[model samples]
Target: MSLPYFHHTPETASNFAQNLRENSVEYVRFELPDLAGLSRGKTVPMNHVESYTLNGLNLYGGAVTLDSASIPIQGTGYNEDINFADCLMVPDPDTVSNVPWLANTARVICDTKWYDGRPQPAAPRTVLKNILSLAAQMGYGVKMGHEYEFYVVDAATRKPLYTGQPIFVTSLLHQHPALDKLMRVLNLSGVDMITANGEYGPSQWELNFAAMDGIAAADRAFVFKNTVKEFLHTEGLLATFMTKPYKGLAGSCSHFHISLYELASGRNVFLDAADKDGMSPIMKQFTAGILEHAAAAQAIWNPTPNCYRRIRPHTFAPSNVSWGVEDRSASVRIKASKDKRQHLEVRVPSALSNPYLTAAATIAAGLLGMQHESVLAPERSGLKEADDSFKKLPTEMHESLAALEADTDFIHMLGSEFVHVFQTVKTAEILRLREDIPAAETNEYFDLY
Candidate 1:
């Protein structure tokens, strides 16, 4: 019933089993975040959980590279190449949490490994872990925060809970009991939520939680999305993190915040009082790296064809690869606090992005910056989208994927295996999208042709 922070071992698993008995737990959901960041795993009865926790459970290896439709793609080197292999889902005991809304149910996050005991390199969570390891070797520890915007709607009707563009409206914030219930459950489940409010779009809401170190932060984000959707579904409502569900409305986004700390001294490494802009040289280089690979990174950030629609002008989404201090208009905004609190806010990721991949790609790019001592361009003043000085980002999923394929340096840093699997899965999605014709397209071309 309490938040657990321990490694998975025989002793720890035994202790966890004892805790489950104490809490009268009936089932444990051994969940894995799949390629599209969907929660996919097995549910085990409490009687079998201890053994599974210690020994791990079997899962389809192809799950790690499944498309948005949950179909495993071929030629990804995970499915057919391995003859549809099974991967081990080894539960990380530290990620155990009580399912506050589901009585007698608990959840534990897991990492995937091949049957032969090798970590699944193409797994999003594994990719993130490797990137964090690289950062640690460079004497830096990463702190991360996520700001997520999503829409709540009636599951049957698919209509917004309310109809208004009321950002930060007090009455609107409390308009739904679902919001209050969600906040309460998340806090009870150890999300450490800080704020929940009505966003710019009707039925849209933004909730934020406390930051944590690298892998832990990404785990929290993955848990947050799954919890919201599951709990809301039980309440006869649907919570969607889709990039854009309605036209002429604000799209959902998950903005990521990151800053590095000196591992040896345990001090914030991005702050520099002597610098004119109050940013340390490391921070600038990190920003430079992010900008340099923004286009390629977009393949991960905006994975789906629909996700690119959220990046248009005046949508509060970035259209160009640019950074500015406190500039929401820029792709990467430097929240300059002139103190330890200073960090980079990457606003490019859509809500549908896998948190693990986002963190991995961001960290990988920044590390390249630090490694090469990359220089940042001058900060721009006006709206980056309007500024001809700034270069435009990839406008479509295909373009982004191509950019990702071309960026050998970035791909090398992120691990070619992971990148290859990601590209294959996303490319499959694009091929499927190309065959589908929307009603708008039919309306515009059917009669004319």
Candidate 2:
């Protein structure tokens, strides 16, 4: 069957259907984004394409309205008593693609909204839209790329089957057979993967993709995560994107490399080689803004309780708020590129974070810097030495919540409704973890550490 093209209008949709029929598409997958940036979807036979494509599908808004555990909060009016709202999942024609693993199956990502046509304020995609709209007013566009690290383990035994020590050891560089298979699948899916290597943790691996514009990058990240998990499952293995599935080794991180571009000319606005640090004035201000607000942004990036455990010192993780030149310890690292592609990498976020929230927080922080003309202090160096100058990141989930609550300005920027819903949901998660002190929980995190 021929590949399906994205359609944006009614005419385009009609043409797309005709093309799919001509190419003998057997089924379609409608993928909807949940609050955590995970895609949940259902498959329908090709015969229903016309009805599903034009009218869209109905989903229980409760699917996304709840926390990770599927519990709905009464205060949010999303509980069972509120009769749980219904929302529409409208396919983004541009995101249509054929799944390489599933024969004759095409998939399209979707945006959700209320049945009455109001946007779901708690939707991760909508929150991103708010940040992008703000970026538009500054005559700049945001571009980002994510470096995702995960652990591929034996599905049945739930153990590391690969030939390597459980921690950082130089002798563990030999390629694993499963990793080779994963790379082949990634290649078939047309992902521009830049690098793949062993991480400091046991059974952990990292994959970096080429950067793209905001929306496209987010789409790629969403597709990449789902594709990796599905492919691994077929091989009787599990791919975990959890921040700290194993406690002692390095936690999985989803580091974002971000840059700003001029909307009209497509020029890299963060570049200025003439400066001593090779950073433009605007770039300095942006980095400073992010560092200043890094504590508040933790609630969005390191939302889960497990996430706070990964921010400790000496783990190659960012334990405090600081900026540096090519220093990985700093929350924000300024790298000097010989070309105009220079960008900054925010290293504090974990793999389990919602992509939309991460991007929005970064954009909002940078914009705050621009608005206030924030000036960055001298760039720090060295990873081993502790710097007391910058505020330390929250050591626990509850502390992170306190930091988030104190930053009213950033919360307001994210929309009061989103902040409230997110806080409520996350707080509930913390309570759940606190209640269940699973024996596996302590062993899983500390055994390898």
Best by lDDT: 1
Tens-digit per-residue lDDT, 1-449, candidate 1: 11111236789789888888898899999998888889999999999988987777888888878888888798999988989989888887678888998789888888888767788888888888888888988999999988899999999999988898999897977877888999989987779999988899998999999999878899899989999998999889999999988998999999999999998997889999897667999999999999999999999898898898899977789999999888888999988898889889999999999999999999999999999999998886777768876789999999999999999999998999998898888888889879988999999999999
lDDT of 2: 0.78
TM-score of candidate 1 versus the correct structure, residues matched by position: 0.96
lDDT of each: 0.88, 0.78
For each candidate, give its TM-score against the true structure: 0.96, 0.91
Candidate 2, residues 349-409: lDDT per residue as tens digits? 9998887788888888888888889999887556622777667888788887888888877
Stretches of candidate 2 above 4 Å error? 1-9, 80-82, 163-175, 438-449
lDDT (C-alpha) at residue 347 in model 2:
91
Clashing pairs in 1: none
- Give the best candidate by TM-score: 1
- Backbone clash count, each prediction separately: 0, 2
